[model samples]
Target: MQRPAYGQSPPLHHPVPQHVSTVPQLRSPPPPIPQQQHQQQAHGYDGSPYQQQPMGAGPSHNVFGQYGNFMNDPAAQLASQFSQTAFKQGTQYLEQNVNRYVNVSALKHYFNVTNSYVINKLFLVIFPWRHKPWSRKQTVGPNGQEGWYLPPRDDINSPDMYIPVMSLVTYILLSTLIAGLRGQFQPELLGYTASKALGVVVLELVGLKLGCYFLSISNESQLLDLVAYSGYKFVGVIGTISLAEIVNKGKGTGGWFGWSVFLYMFLANSLFLMRSLKYVLLPDNHGDARGPMQTGDTRAKRNQRTQFLFIYSYVVQFAFMWFLSRP
Candidate 1:
């Protein structure tokens, strides 16, 4: 070791290190663990630890953080579920049954129906004789439902609901106009006309259903088919009424114009129904011509059935519509 300089700090002396003894004090054993804890360890838990997931907060975009708890009500959740279920059920029911008697989609198949076609169909209703026979233009869809590929030009069996629906509205409006022109218009009259038209439709539908049952045509399930058939009279009625409206404006006719139109429409409607409803009412190729096994009793019965249906569909329906359409 070198000696310190005169002006520098002197070197410090180091004390010898002494070992301090960690006294081996007697240690007390940890207090005995509770029996309850031991039991818990042995049995895991009394009930399921993960009973259910915590409900998450629903999305509330741009909402203040304080109001983030909205839409979390249990009753609201239950009501939402109920409404969703009810809506689903109601729509499903309507979808299936709405088209049972009238398929609106079938009427508006753009390729099959047009303005020109709609106008042309009026003549078909007036002159059903021009249509020779029911054409076999049925096509089976992917869902196994059969439908027309294109409506037959003049056949009564051509189920064109568009004509009936359109002509019905037209007929109502025309009748209303005629009534208004004569100062006979009433708010209730509109209701009367609409109700009358609808009543006739329902009545006709029921009548056809019954007719098919009594006749046992085996085609009664074609209820909408018959509905379309029955609606044809509206066309002739509408046409006749329109013609009468023009003729009555001559000032001397009093109201003969309306009466004259009613009579002519009656005749025209009868003819149309007679021709169109025959296939349903009358079986073509009567007698032994149809089959060798055909019995005389069966033939006679069919003839009688045909006669009954001819009158029931033509005369009876014409009377009903004629009476109802009176302003």
Candidate 2:
């Protein structure tokens, strides 16, 4: 090595270059992140041990495959068993008790009705259009189709026992809410609610049964028929009380809503009874079915009697409801 000038740096020495290795490096590529890991990161969830394995494996390879079946699901098994047991019990109870009381054919027929028919009747009870096709006829066929021989009218027999019961329950619930709003809630009222409503139902059934007996129609009617028919006023009662609740709700009494619904209830109930009771009240003339046709005079008389009976029945029902539904 020669010495450079005073300002110049010393010469650099290059080391011998290392020989290039002919063999490739054995290091593996970093494993790609799994889709599950990405999902867990995005959702901020710890990847569960249950979901660690890839899906759609053969039964032989999958350890959790048997658990995939519905029978192996704890929650699904519990719900299915509970529902089945409840349904079986309910069906048994209905068959034992309710079936013996009511006409089975009639009950099944009523149950077969569509939701549209019931909803339409509910709407029409307010509007009551009196036109062709829409107009309700009070007359039954000469063969007394109103009897068990034919199905009851859709508009007349809609909802049956279910509506009455559900409406009464809803009424009690709403009344409880109203009472709570007024700071008058009492758990004791719940007991009285069931008893009083049930008492009213029993009273109405007895009253209607007595009336039918007096009218000589008891032979043709079952006790549960009166029960069903009498319970129908609860529908109007529920509607009226609901309107009153929406209006009164801790305030003063319903101003327009109360009176308006009351009036409508009266009219609707009367009209409903008119259509529903016509068959029972005014059966076709016995002679017309076999011998000669009924005279117009007799027909008119029956119609008049039916009209009077309807007015009397609905007015009585309205009065009973007025007293029963008072808050």
Candidate 3:
């Protein structure tokens, strides 16, 4: 092509045109697509065939559906079932083992005492000279059987482990306090004292069991009942030691004053035991209706049991109390 002169209005040159195709050309970039239609077609490049969906549809809609599918899976169902079975079996095993050695209901009864009952029982234990009836109150059961002892909350004569447990703990604490006051307190001394006190109680219990066995005593009283009765001596021992200490002005539990106080407590405790145990050792005598007539051998055996009871109440109590009261 020849260049046009600058002065002359550039000669209009006809531009060479390329071959036109049948497809129509876009004007102004095909007028920009509507925003809604553009959004609808936005997923075109995801390599998936476009399908019309509801306006608000999104990934969030499938969340619960996926979860439901997972829950319906056999593996998940089986795992859930296994966990429930394991929990139930573990619960049953624990309950069985717990029920084996421990009498949960009986323990509840022993502790089911009222404050009034406790106070009255304490008074009776301390002073039995005035109180008349020593036998425990009996009730008729649903099965029409008599001789069902009333709960401690209802009867003062009902044996309860509550007082015994409290008194034993108190005794140990008081002993620790006494040791502290006497400048004999040691950390290990607490354990030693508790062990010694418990050991003495065990020995007394064993001795009583042996006596019961040899004397052919009825097994109406449970083992815990015997423990409760034997533990009464601790109350007297506590009184004796405490009074002796006070009398000696925290100096020591020695001298005639201490001995006199101890002797009084020992005698009081012995009397309490004698009265309390009378009902247990001689149940046939306490009932409203007299039992079957006894043969000579039975009478002789009863007399022997009576003698054994006296010796145990006085002699054994005296010996144990004297040993325990030592500062």
Q: How close is every model to the real structure, measured as TM-score?
A: 0.57, 0.58, 0.69
Clashes of each: 0, 0, 0
Predicted candidate 3 versus true structure: per-residue lDDT over 1-327, tens digit per residue: 888787888768887658558558787654445864666555433234665555435564568778889999999999999999999999989878988977677677788899999999888877777887777777886798876778999998888888888888888999999999878899998887789789889998898888877776655445667888888888888888898898899865689988888888888888888887766665474372212223333778788878888998899999988888886
> Per-residue lDDT of 98-142 in model 1, one digit per residue for the tens?
879656575454224556666666766665556666432446556
Q: Candidate 2: which pairs clash?
A: none
Q: By the TM-score metric, which is better: model 1 or model 2?
A: 2
Candidate No. with top lDDT: 3
Local distance difference test scores for all models = 0.63, 0.62, 0.79
List candidate 1 stretches off by more than 4 Å: 1-90, 93-112, 134-157, 250-263, 283-297
